[model samples]
Target: MRHLTVFDLDGTLVDTPRAIVETFTAAFGALGIAPPDASAIRATIGLPLGQAFGALLGLPADDELVASGVRRYQIHFKEIILPRAPELMFPGVTEGLDELRGLGITLAVATSKVHASADALLRSAGLRDLFALVVGADQVAHPKPHPESGRLILRTLGVPAESAVMVGDTVHDLHMARAAGMRSIAVTYGVHGPRELAEARPTWIADTFDDVVGLLRAAPKGLAG
Candidate 1:
């Protein structure tokens, strides 16, 4: 069977906290509301835009204020964040991805970002072509920690859950992988710290992007459990 690897975009493949923080701050300022502190915003990095805004503003996800915030965030993201895509890639990401492909392992992305934004960011960073599929929050009825995104990727890619591993930087990603009956590799360099990630019970914990590549290369098939 062909091995498959599903990755989380933000905090995993891309270092997006700075851009995300700036965009959220800009959006809240546009709404004349004080933005959440950077740490609070960072805590919500792996969630969908509505959920992130809701958590930050203490509003319901479907509230008009949250909707407005989402709109403003998108505008600022496109104007400010997208332009900096090239600088957002994590170290060793490009080389590691190339090495994974060279190993003949299929790769896909499951991100909380909206489909259009995820696609645009990856394309702008020149990493879009590396993925066989990119499933974003908008493409799923429920997002991470719910297993919808992982299941969607597996089903769409025709890869069994056991033949794949989910690599990410947040509890949401690890939980999603477990819920989907797939093994997970948690990277320590992202949103959540090692202690928090350990609570998620990933199959392995990697300290860097190169570590993730090494784990996959060392046990391309066995890592899936």
Candidate 2:
């Protein structure tokens, strides 16, 4: 009977594979470094920019190279990628969200994207006003998998962890839910597969956005009708 739902933005709600791939590719070129394969970039979508850059480049998390890469990625993403091809909501996203809202469920966003960018993306996609809270990676001391973002969202929304669920597409999202002591629903159509999400042990797995809405509709007595 989860009353509060925290969602991961990039792959779960919005389709940003193309923007991510192109941004990182352009960023790597800006740094005069060889670009990682597109798959490599896709695999790191849910992580914070610095961590994603570190993972893609095989550098230490705090390395100067990682910082430089993150900066470059942000620049290209804002200046070129976002303007050229802003990410769009995935199929059924708006409808599912609308249905959930109608059911009196509170929605929030917990994403690894920086605050301004995350805000702008949601606004551009006509979703900024839908979420009750939008916790960004930069707003927290630690991002997903550490639970800072999730915990903050729950606290701000005044929702108990046990009465909330994190809906996401990546292991990071599931792990963050577990770490925050909340239930998790993993979607398979995002950045990661069921095998990867299973490693994080989500309470449920959804194949489509409508399936996620169904899960909410079936929630306990007070949560759903």
Candidate 3:
């Protein structure tokens, strides 16, 4: 049986940390607040938009301030992030995925980013057709750490979670995969890094998307569908 390879967008598939920082800075500046600390904002990369906004702005997730923060962020990211998205696709991501696709593995992209933006970025990066399933924060009823997105992606691919691997850069990804009863591969070269990702105890921990392919290759057979 072919296994599934489910990926997280943003930190895992694209290196948007620098672009995110720029956008967030634009957001805060647009709001006339002292620009947020870059490291703090970057650390919040993998989280859902509301949570990331709230945390960055020190507002409750449902607070009005959060709305404002989101508006500010959207104003900039929607316009700038896509074009100048940080080119952090590591050294081996595209080629790796291409090779994996040639292996007849099922691939999907699950992201905290909105569907439109995720699709655009993937296309802009020349990776549009690589995924059979594209699940985004807006496409699901719930976000990461809530299994819904992962479950949805697996359902779309007609694959059981047990036969899939979720590769991401955060605990949130691990949590969602675990909730969906799938194995998780943590990539450390993103926002969370290795230290923060250790708590998840991923099935494998790789340092780059390039390195992740080797890890998947080494994974038990029938795991990278």
* List of clashing residue pairs for candidate 1: none
Per-candidate clashes, comma-separated = 0, 0, 2
Q: State which candidate, 2 or 3, has the greater TM-score.
A: 2
Give the per-residue lDDT digits (tens) of candidate 1, residues 96-192: 9999999999999999999999999999888999999999999999999899999998888899988899999999999999999898899999999
Among residues 3 or more apart in sequence or in different chains, the pairs in candidate 2 whose N, CA or C atoms overlap within 3 Å are: none
Best model per TM-score: 1
Q: Could you tell me how far off, in angstroms, the CA of residue 183 lies in candidate 2 after the best superposition?
A: 0.8
lDDT at 53 for candidate 1? Answer: 92
Preferred candidate (lDDT higher): 1 or 3? 1
Model 3: per-residue Cα lDDT over 144-221, one tens digit each: 889999999888778887788999988999999989989989988777868778888788898877678876776647
List candidate 3 stretches off by more than 4 Å. 220-225
Query: Candidate 2, residues 1-225: lDDT per residue as tens digits?
Result: 448989998988888866889899999999998899998998888889988998888889899999999888888877764553334678888889999999888999999999888887888788888899899999999998888999999888889988898999999999999999888899999889889888888989999999999997776453321
Candidate 3 TM-score, C-alpha based: 0.92
Please name the candidate that would achieve the greatest lDDT relative to the true structure.
Answer: 1
Q: Which ten residues in a row have the lowest lDDT in candidate 1?
A: 216-225
Superposed model 2: Cα runs more than 4 Å off: 84-87, 220-225
